[model samples]
Target: MSFKYIDVIKELINKIENSQLDVMEKVAQLCAETIIRGNILYFFGTGHSHMISEEPFYRAGGFVPVYPILETSLMLHDGAYKSTLMERVNGLSKILLEQSGATKDDIIFIISNSGRNNVTVEMAIEAKEKGLKVIAITSLIHSKSVKSRHPSGKKLYEIADYVIDNCGVVGDAAVQYENFEQKTGPTSTIAGVLIVNSVISRAVEIILDKGWKPPIFMSSNTDEGDEFNKKILQKYKSRIKLL
Candidate 1:
């Protein structure tokens, strides 16, 4: 591999390691408090970043109160596939927020690699206006260096109340390891995993500090599925409504 790749990866680790723990603490506090207050946590992402949104759901030790605001409905899942031009012309952010039943007490986590897409930006705006605290996971270096496609020229960082910079390049590749001519995949996958783990760990701490057992889910594949399912459901009984 090239020295450029090595250097970038090292830099990313340093940035995250040196990050202010205050942000994670705040997020955990918000999440625990919101759930305790009977509000939901909404997560949204576009394209590849959608994987990040799925990381925390239905996993062992995962929260049950998260709403992934991706349109899984057959009619609006993909605008490009829509038969009607009007359906394709619609602003997806509004629909997502409306369907999720977002409110002032809800928290939103938005994952965007570029932090420049119209849908993600609009969701951040809508959530913010509705009094939601939005957390953004995106690449700072990439977003700053690249020209945004948002018409208002606003990027993800501009809209988020808390910004978590995922260490990666514009193409999310560190260097040309596989092909000596071009850069390959960078640390986005690593960043996504790290962010989710950190969120969960800190959330556990906050929950414990509040004298409550953390409401974490266990895999349905587990032998203790019934017990775990009961625990998770009881923990999140009134906060989450799954369709």
Candidate 2:
């Protein structure tokens, strides 16, 4: 049998539709609370998974005060293979957290499709130790099937305060075809994006329920949009390094 591109889209949409609303709501509530308390929301991941962290950071129509704890050593552009190795090294999470100045009131989002890597797990553990709330976006099936690389023998999902499973398979490739033993289409990225956006939408909803006008970025293209975002930038530029 042959699998077409729409097949992958259908599979991904099904996964998203079936994703646990409770877990996603928990993540959103945490983010909304962080925003209410005027604290930062932090995101961290490694390699391809790091792209998930960048999805909401400093973007138009995105929430303000969201920071991505990006480390070049673990990012692909610098060295893909090197990033993989760096994610396995213990104690790196602490450095990243310290540099970010994450606090108990902050919300930290850690993304790892597989959830087995040492650094992602370690970062969640470290974040909790620092009194920060951690939300993990990972594959429950994948993490359960794989052994943890961390010394604690715990996966990212186990360490985070809120665990929102991407509901993907172990290897994350969803489409299969005859004569191809290994699947071709990887669905984790799109599924993850959907989950993250859902969480953000829910967070905004919760904030509005509380009668607070949450600070969200506006598009840079429009005149009012530019003015609105510029003020937000001027207010947070000192606190946010990337702003």
Candidate 3:
């Protein structure tokens, strides 16, 4: 990568590390408590931030019962149930959630670099109205400038019960290039993963504090893989997100 891109990455990493650890702890506590109490977690991202949902969905060493809310269905190609205007990020989310099976006792994680998109704010409002706990992963600086697309004038930050900053720029670090501008950087994907891992680590701490082993999966290549993962899956079965 070019020096400019490297500089951008360093800045974002610094921002994330230098951000309020207090806020991260609080967010982790909320998520951990909710999950342990048997609430579902729904991860939603319309565009590039969709990558945020990938880890918690099917990967090992992740919580079991997480759901990925995307514009597409089981098939990658758009179908009858999928969004027609994939270009319109917000509208696509609305259509997808209208058909979702989310309930009142669930949790919603809205991931967006800008956090000002119409879809994210709409999902947050709808989820809150349905009595779901809302957690937002977005860039604070980026979202500060983008107003809510909804007529109610509420952004993701305003509606979320907990906010985790991805620490990426609002424009997504694409502006650093004089010519070949790219629209993403080290925040939504990198910081998003770090945030999830941190949440999992803290949650494990809490679980262990209760004198129970954390339900983390041992490496499949290990002898204890089957037993450890069995517990993890049994605990987080319904909370795992599917893309």
Candidate 4:
């Protein structure tokens, strides 16, 4: 019980280290192809899953072509309950997706740990309808355990062109203590981050192999880092909604 969280983290690492290489490489390949073709890569999620979309957007060592759809209504702020309600509201994603500038050559990633949310599912559907490729980051174990909230009775993984499982347990909590009903450690965030970064890094490596310089952001504190990132920032600020 004392080391349950540690055990949980170890399991998460093992999941990432083993059996995820094929999916990670495939995701990277798609991302690299998008970037090499000068197309955008968009990410979207609701609730806690939003953190994964936030991972690759204009951050240090991140790519400029990767954009995050940050719809305030679906985020946890001001009124979390309102955010929760909005996530289940149908047809909302269509309005957001229409303005995202995602094209047929681009890719859209929708994340939902349970793979059973109305917003994420609708976003993927809309993206696909627009001829964009859809990738999903979710826990298949969790999705299979629960019913999808979408009216179509389909999960995010079912709609996406690619699926990467976070391998997290249902409800996203993994730690169990003696005599306690609730689990403490929510492993989805950690697992999601790992999956996001690993895929992006692999994409970068693939780009490097081709001798084409990928626009990777550097920390602003360095002497020339600001100048280096400034060019990429200016180029993408107008294209990406939340730059």
Candidate 5:
């Protein structure tokens, strides 16, 4: 039996490594600058894309000031189908951004596989209006194939200051079987997590090169991890909600 899903994922990862390295480096530089300026990093997404937003928050080896802009209505747990409708709502992005307490000069990563939804597109616009840098992680193939769902006729990639293609295909599912009507094994989550973690790791290196220690979280499973995490959490608890 062949593992077609794994093979497909490996191919996509290779594409990202070869095609997205330059853009990832630029994003890392922005992250390093934002952290050095005492600004936080915000992440936002809807539906399955929200997983990318939550991936680095409070995660081991993740940055301390990372904030995931989570809205119950936009998540799968509350109502997966409803979240799909909610992400199309025009004004919700502004409300979420305001509630996030994000300020100017911060950086926000907006993940949307399609990149055509109103919420993610508007979120990028709103972040730009607030003087925050917007970095979008989306599938160029998927996004370009569809028209914008935003009133401005702009997709997340069009609005963001930087765009990192997840190198995923349209509809995201990568594995298909003989006689199957629909594909299985989505690639966005895996590709997105890799893209995000790689950039964050590079940002840490950039910070170290600049002579500043990046506030990284240690695994709570390890000895001395709790104490280390507590000190780091205390520093950003006021700024990062859900910390």
Candidate 6:
């Protein structure tokens, strides 16, 4: 049997390498600067997009100063249907940002595949208003095809300081079947995660080049890893609420 999803992801990886290298490096530079300045790097998303926000938080080899703005209502664990409704709600992003304890010195990555939702767009707007740099990870083709759900008449890409296109198709599903009317196998999560990790990994390299030791987590399963991670965790526990 042919694995179509695997092929699709592989194709996306190639596109990312070819088209996104410069922008990814640009974002990495900002990330390295943020770390050197003793600032946090935050990630926010709604619904399934929230998974990308959590991807780097406390992960092995991930940055220690990273935070994910995980609002309960915007996430799917409590109720997926409710989370969808919340993502369209206006004025919620302000509260979410206020509660996340993000400061003007921090940088945020906002992930929304469509980039048209009110909450995500507003989050980008609000973050910029508070003097933080915003990096948007979204599907450009999909966002451009849709109308903005925000009252400001802006999409995430329009409001972000840096936009990293996921290069995904309009509906984000890549596999098509002869008998099926709709495409299956969503690719946004796969593409988005790869983009985020690649940028952060590159940031680590930049930090090293600057002769700074970036705080990174180790796999707890490794010998002595737990001890090392505990110290790192303790250092950021006050700033990173989820830690």
Off by over 4 Å in 1: 1-11, 72-90, 177-179, 234-243
lDDT of 4 by residue, 39-98 (tens): 888999999888889988878898898888889889998479999889899999999988
In candidate 5, what are the lDDT values of residues 115-143, reduced to their tens digit? 99888998999999999999999999999
Worst 10 residues of 1 by lDDT: 81-90
Question: Who wins the lDDT comparison?
Answer: 6
Q: What is the C-alpha lDDT profile of model 1 across 1-243, one tens digit per residue?
A: 346756677777777767745676777777888766766778887666777887786667777777777654312346534422322223778777877778898899998878876777788888998999999988888888876565667888889999888867778887665447676656786787677678777787777888877666777887998686876686555545552
By TM-score: ranked, best first: 6, 5, 4, 2, 1, 3
Q: Candidate 2 or 6, higher lDDT? A: 6
Candidate 5 ranges with C-alpha deviation above 4 Å: none
Sorted on lDDT, best first, the list reads 6, 5, 4, 2, 1, 3
Off by over 4 Å in 4: 1-3
What's model 6's lDDT at 156?
96
| Candidate number with the higher lDDT (1 or 3) | 1
Model 3: residues >4 Å from true position, as ranges?
1-3, 73-100, 174-186, 219-243
List of clashing residue pairs for candidate 3: 64-240, 65-236, 65-239, 65-240, 66-239, 66-240, 66-241, 67-240, 67-241
* TM-score, candidate number 3: 0.78
RMSD of each: 4.1, 1.7, 4.0, 1.3, 0.9, 0.8
Which residue pairs in model 4 clash with each other?
none
How far is 108's C-alpha from truth in model 3 (Å)? Answer: 1.6
Q: Cα lDDT of model 5 overall?
A: 0.93
lDDT of candidate 1 at residue 62, scale 0 to 100: 75
**Can you list the residue pairs that collide in candidate 6?**
none
Q: Per-candidate TM vs. native?
A: 0.83, 0.95, 0.78, 0.96, 0.98, 0.98
Model 4 TM-score, 2 decimals: 0.96
The lDDT values for all models are 0.74, 0.85, 0.69, 0.88, 0.93, 0.94
